[model samples]
Target: MPVNVYRNESLVQMETYEAEPARVDELVEQVRAKWSLLREHGYAGDYPIEVLRGNRNGGNIKVVEVFRWKSVQDRINAQTDPDYVALAGQISSLTTAEGTKETYTQAVRGFNHNFPSVGGVELLKGVCSCLLTIDGVVKDYQMSVKNGIVLMHRSPRMDLDGDGRNEMYLKILMHGGEIIQAALGPIRVEQNFNRPNDGIVKSNSAGGSDFPGTAIWRVSWKIHTPMGPVLTDPDQPLIFGPATVNHYPPVGTHFHSPTGPVALVHEETGARVGTLTPGELTAFDIVVTKDDEIYADVLNTPPADIFEVMEEWRNRMGDQEVQPVVAGATDGVM
Candidate 1:
């Protein structure tokens, strides 16, 4: 089976403006609305877009906005897009041209930033659930992660193919920014995109193993490691600062779960994973080992239990919604 490599180049843009003392708040809100318009018009970037306001020497406010361009073409398109142009006009009317500046920069790779440590041991946590099937027998799995690695295994080892032992196992390591290794049973594949050799580092860690039939895996997970938080939902991009809601499609064409059920059947054994009812949608990442072992990290939450989960939360919180207040001495002001 052939593998797919997805890559996209993005540019970070920084803009600064000076605003009159009285119009500072108004200018900031206008700039924010402008960014929202650009996002609504599909001109926003992949990473988080920031708008910061600070006090200048003369009491005039300095506003700085930082964001990434999805691509060079998107940057070009935004300049001509009517929605963006109109909003840009509104923003320019509120700023002083003397202090305005804009610059674009690209990231330099092969460098690691120092991340804060806790108790001298950096911990990575990933929480997810999976619907796993072995020999037509299905079971639900709630997976756990440790030290930036996800491990899955079957308990009470049973011989599904009469192999005299249990053989279901999987390990996913995401210590760095990208997926570096994935193992299914005896087969494994590894790669390091940061290195010059971007191809597979080791296609097979163990001796090749026979293909497993009709493996049904519905896994939804969020991995928080030293590199960053990894999300399966393509709609939610990773951000270093505050994130805005994005309902648009992901950066590129990656396979994702649909609104309805999805069923996969094996050609040879005629075995199939059961169909799911329509419910919440999640991202699907399918990795196939060099030995033809397949792992589909697609998670689908059933519709029937959605309300039950919500009700449980309501009960636990005494049917009250949690609200935030000022840190201290604010008399309940937010």
Candidate 2:
């Protein structure tokens, strides 16, 4: 009797073999359940599926990797336990550790007295045009600005195709640091260039007059909130009082800082729309990639909105339902 099969690409079946061995292990478990349903929804991390068994050129398959790449510290420890509490509400009630290093030195000298200084042609046109054309080279870089994004730090070179260039190094902390975070420890670089994708050139910034199609460009100042001014130039109009440049919302919103993590937004329904109370904890949007770079987590930070960092991780046990997942999980819809 005949026997051939072939699936997804048609031919269904045409069997006849009768050599027992439990019917050839139930026909190799129905061809591994149709190749795991054509590798769960048909090919993505494309090409990589072996399973041979000698005969033709000494075969012996078992390869497997139709998609697999999760490192950046395994995606930043996938949200390192302890209900994360907005990353442990990065507070400083001055409980210990020298009051958490004197409350992180008065929260970095009162947030760098209104941190906003990356000029000098946006940091030398972001280190010679987006770190030598997308991380070809750029000796150990670093920068900071917490809870408002802008954190490049972590770096290394040669992207050997780990996407994220080399590994977890969050960029889009841009001001002229053209979309980096291309490499670090375990590999990353998934669709980088979160901004400045329109012509990308700075030749040291063409004297700012929109040369080369609006020359000297680079984004991610969180693009000025509200989804960064409706994703930059969504037909302009992001008017936020008092010479807006990052002092955010409905006119300064009375010095936004609900005791700890900042809050307030209505920049076109990213929601949370308002909050300076209940020990604030908003996150309508905040892009920072590394800890295994993925991007697009959105919501899941609720372990008590952060009461003293979930009481210091529930006094070191963590769990009152423990939450905070969504570090942009990019793999089979997280």
Candidate 3:
């Protein structure tokens, strides 16, 4: 009997196989060889888009194949093709378990900076902001063009504290100034644009009687549970330094979390700005300056809970006896 094949509207198909520990390598090679035949017979489009292999429990091996097909029908047809039948039969002999296939629709896909492209170029523009809160005071700063040049760099998502969850960071340079840096996370549901710049710090030089340029930074975050916004150290600035005349010192801030140290980076250029050296500092060393200096305000409430807020609004409207309009009613007549 012919093997069962799944069908869907998507152009992508994923096939997972389980094999014996000793035969895992052989199974992978056979699959790779079968891909060539499938492409030649037009049963499959191109080669597999992604291939992953790993060891599971009981010394078994798992191989996952992500194939990008020319169309959904092409994938369906390939499963029953004589060439595929023979190929699958050979691969099955090496496995101790049945294979599973799943199909998924592509939402969005893009290459990173290091990937080779036609123009040999990469996208280097991104946004970074900082949230400063101290003594129950809040302030924000965003990277912008200064002297016709942007002065910020954004780094790729990294687990600086080795917390498993990835975090993106931003770095910027400013004239002598002071501001509190708050722990923040992403506010938007689709974090493709705005990301969490957790554990980033800034530094400045010393100047004589000059109002040093304050680096206003802000980030957004939400709790996993339904706990409301909670500020832990409201009276502490992550880092603070004095102003310098005609000279901007390489004064940088660093934080030593329980897991490890985290550093800051440039928002636009993605270059390492300062090192996050392991050190000792008390909460009293931090300070909160002014709330009036904040540039923009970002709410920390999660968008996932918008339904609850809307329900409350609906209740208020019901209490007010707001009438619903009839369909096709004229203005002010319903």
User: Quick one: best lDDT, which candidate?
Assistant: 3
Candidate 1 lDDT at 58 equals 76
Model 3 Cα lDDT, one tens digit per residue, 49-160:
5678997766888998777677667777887888788988998898787788787753332213221111111112222222222112222222121111112333332333
- Going through the candidates in the order shown, the clash numbers are 0, 21, 23
- Model 2 Cα shift for residue 205 (angstroms): 38
What TM-score does prediction 3 earn?
A: 0.31
Alpha carbon lDDT of residue 298, candidate 1? 23
- Model 2 over residues 23-111: C-alpha lDDT tens digits? 33443444344334433533212223333321224332221111221222432443453333232233111111211111011111111
RMSD of model 2, in Å? 26.6
Q: List residue ranges in candidate 3 displaced over 4 A.
A: 1-9, 109-334
**Candidate 2: C-alpha lDDT:** 0.22
Worst-scoring 10-residue span by lDDT in model 2? 100-109
How many residue pairs of model 1 clash at the backbone? 0
Candidate models: Cα lDDT each: 0.36, 0.22, 0.37
Clashing pairs in 1: none
Candidate 2 stretches with Cα past 4 Å from truth are 1-153, 157-263, 268-273, 276-334
Candidate closer to the true structure by TM-score (higher is better), 1 or 2: 1
RMSD in angstroms, candidate 3?
23.4
